[model samples]
Target: MINKKNQETLSHHLQKLEDISPKQLNKDQKDLIKKMLELLFNDPNTTTLEFENAYRVLIQRVKVGFTFDAAPSEAKNTISLLVKDEEKSFVNDPLKPHNQLIIGENYDALKNLLVIEGERESKVLTLFTM
Candidate 1:
C-alpha cells in the first residue's frame, strides 16, 4: 500500500515526467532523475546503466494496483487558489474577490479544475498556483 508521503512523491515524479519531451532534453527531468538516483543509492554520480536500472526499478514499483479514486466536480468560472489542509488566516483580496478556495490534494484538485474548465465555452486566460 502507498503511504501519503509516497503518494506525494510519486505525484511529483509523475508531474516531472509529464513535462519531459522526446524532441529535446529537459533540465527538470534530468534533475528529477538525479534526485531519484540520490534517494535510491545515496549517490548522484550515476552511470547510464545504473540510471536505466533505477528507471526500470521505478517502473516496476509503479506497476502496482494504485488508482486515482477522486471524481471530478463542477466549478464556477473564477480564479482558483489551491491550498492544503492548513487554514490560512489572511486573505490578500477579501473585497471584490473572484477567487475560489480549493482545499485538498493539489493533484486531484488540478484534475478536477481541468475537467470543469473543459466543459466551458470560454477559454481560461491563465491559471496561477502556489
Candidate 2:
C-alpha cells in the first residue's frame, strides 16, 4: 500500500505532467511522460527512487525509445481520396461513383473514411478483404 505522502507526491507529479504544454514536447515525448505517470500512479509498489529516476530522465530529455529519421517529424492528418482506375476496373456504372481500392495504412484510411463517409446522407459499407 502506498503511504499518503507518496500518494500526494504522485498526484502532484501527475498534475505537473498534465500542465506541460503540448507544443513544448513532441507526441512521442508526451506519450512517454504520460505513460510513466500512469505507471507511477497505478502501481502501489512504486518507489521514491523510481520517481526520481523518471523525473531525471524527463528533465534531462534522455533518449528512451528507438530513434529513427522520421522520429522528429510531426504526424500529418490527411484525408485520402479513393479514385477509381478505369483501366483496371472490371465494372463501371455511369450513374454511380466508381468503386475504389485504397492501399495504405489502415488507421489513417479508417480515419479518412469515417470523416468522408460521415458527411454522406447514406450509410457506407466498408469491407476489409485483407
Top-scoring candidate (TM-score): 2
Model 2, residue pairs in steric clash: none
The list of candidate 2 runs beyond 4 A from truth reads 26-28, 62-130
lDDT of 2 by residue, 16-129 (tens): 666765555566776788787768756767677787677767745533443345355435764568765788766567888787676775766577667767855244333332
Return the top candidate by lDDT: 2
Models 1 onward score TM values of 0.24, 0.38
Q: lDDT tens string, model 1, 1-130?
A: 3346544554665565556553233465456665675465434464445645776665453346354556866555655554444565455685766777867868656776676667442444333321
Q: Which runs in model 1 stand beyond 4 Å of their true positions?
A: 1-16, 19-34, 38-45, 71-130
All models: lDDT?
Answer: 0.55, 0.66
